[model samples]
Target: MEMKNNTVEVNHIRKAYGNRAVVNDLSFVVKPGEIFGLIGPNGAGKTTTIRMMMDIIKPDSGEVKILGETLTEGAKNNIGYLPEERGLYKKLSVIDSIIYFASLKGVDAKTAGKRAEELLKRVDMIGHRQKKIEELSRGMGQIIQVIVTIIHSPQLIILDEPTASLDPVNAQLLKEIMLDLRKQGKTVIMSTHRMNEIEEMCDRILMINKGRLVLYGDIPSIKAKYRNNSVLIEFQGELGEIPGVTEKRPHDHAVELMLDNKTTPQMVLETLVHKRINVNRFELSTPSLNEIFIKVAGDERE
Candidate 1:
């Protein structure tokens, strides 16, 4: 339980329903003051894992140490969580709902009121402060849930699909708030399907598939390891088969060349030129996070 400097430590955790294991021997660590991404495809048991970590449910095996201690009533005060599903009192006014959630975390009514005002303003929802939760749009409701999640300014925040309902502008606003939290040295665990957001905001990522870890490490290293194995080329003339190119995919007017183990980008470029292919553009490129996600998770039909 004494995880010294780590904020979260999930060790060999396993969960099952009947004979099917949803999460199998999963283990990962989240460092303090960093944005950590928990990512996987639909039904990959991401929410189940998060539920176990939050103590909303228990793992069938192994342990979860949160903030260096076993989760307890007092420990819950230091954590904030936004479930994937929206849960708000529809009859309650926006301000009242915020205040109620804050109060549950030991925030005084008056102080919670002031913080609610600031948060509402920050999210550009101050005008809807007195409206009932049922009266707001889906996007507006998502923002309210976020306000409720962080009303107490907890040290560790866990968000599941935090931007699911927002428009581009509102999603950008939420992303900004997340960045601000990182600046404040708060540990954030974000589980979202948006790979662009994950790549942009997370310091490290733990990618899971079928409830097991597929990739876990700092973003740059993972990208370097998986991305540099290919190159992009745009040529005008007829393309000839190039040696050392293991796979080729036509991308628009260009081609993406996946190199073999011993082939480098420089070698490929030299071969293209030597073969008299009129190259328009030849550049080394890295695969996007989305591409990597698909490659690792694979097709469900498969």
Candidate 2:
């Protein structure tokens, strides 16, 4: 058996439709046993890149290596892929539908059926195993889709917006399952626009926009690189007044202060003390993934 290390590698990949490029010169790697986040805005070439990786669509240029080898039928069978735009057979019962999809992934029918039932139970959908797909709620069907995606227990699972159309309870369950998969030494490639999920689950991330790589690295390092020169303060009564603060946004007795180029956090504290301001909390923190994501991916401000 090959020792676990780099699970996926995409080198200078590019894909196009007619004259329009979808994924332009994109490149990234997914390490084993980690949730690697692939995030971008709508029409940002996320799906295009994923398809190339799966060999569902060939990249116009570049190569994708899985488990240190070229993609093949064996590679595809060992990978679980849940597309963003997905559907289950409406006329088929839940268990049968799950079993069918898992079988397509090369799992034996008996094993697929058994694993499907267990997964449905885990997601609190065991009672509806016999129900037709159309009979279940949208959230329930989405859960089933996820179950099918992982029923084969593949080494690499790629989820494209897996939490879409799911309720909070099921969403939390899916998040827990993703984390558990990581713990079991399974590599997951998650593509989503949700910053909270990325922050909570991904060990590293690659952010792309307009079919080009924008940001790539571990979350903490990216946060540090994009740290806004600001302080988040929580104090009682009133903020009163403080110097060196270029701008401020207040919220529920707390304020986010944007400091001037020459203003230090220490100066702000000293000023507060000299002014006799009641201080409850003083902290300087890195910018959130949401903020940085918007900065790189655009917030539709243009």
Q: Which stretches of candidate 1 lie over 4 Å from their true place?
A: 1-4, 236-241, 246-248, 272-279, 299-302
Show the lowest summed lDDT stretch of 10 residues, model 1: 1-10
lDDT of every predicted structure (CA atoms): 0.91, 0.88
TM for every model, in the order presented, reads: 0.91, 0.89
Number of the top TM-score candidate: 1
Candidate 2 ranges beyond 4 A from true positions:
235-245, 248-251, 270-277, 299-302
lDDT per residue (tens digit) for residues 219-293 in model 2: 999998998788888876667667889889886767989999899889998988887778888888688899898
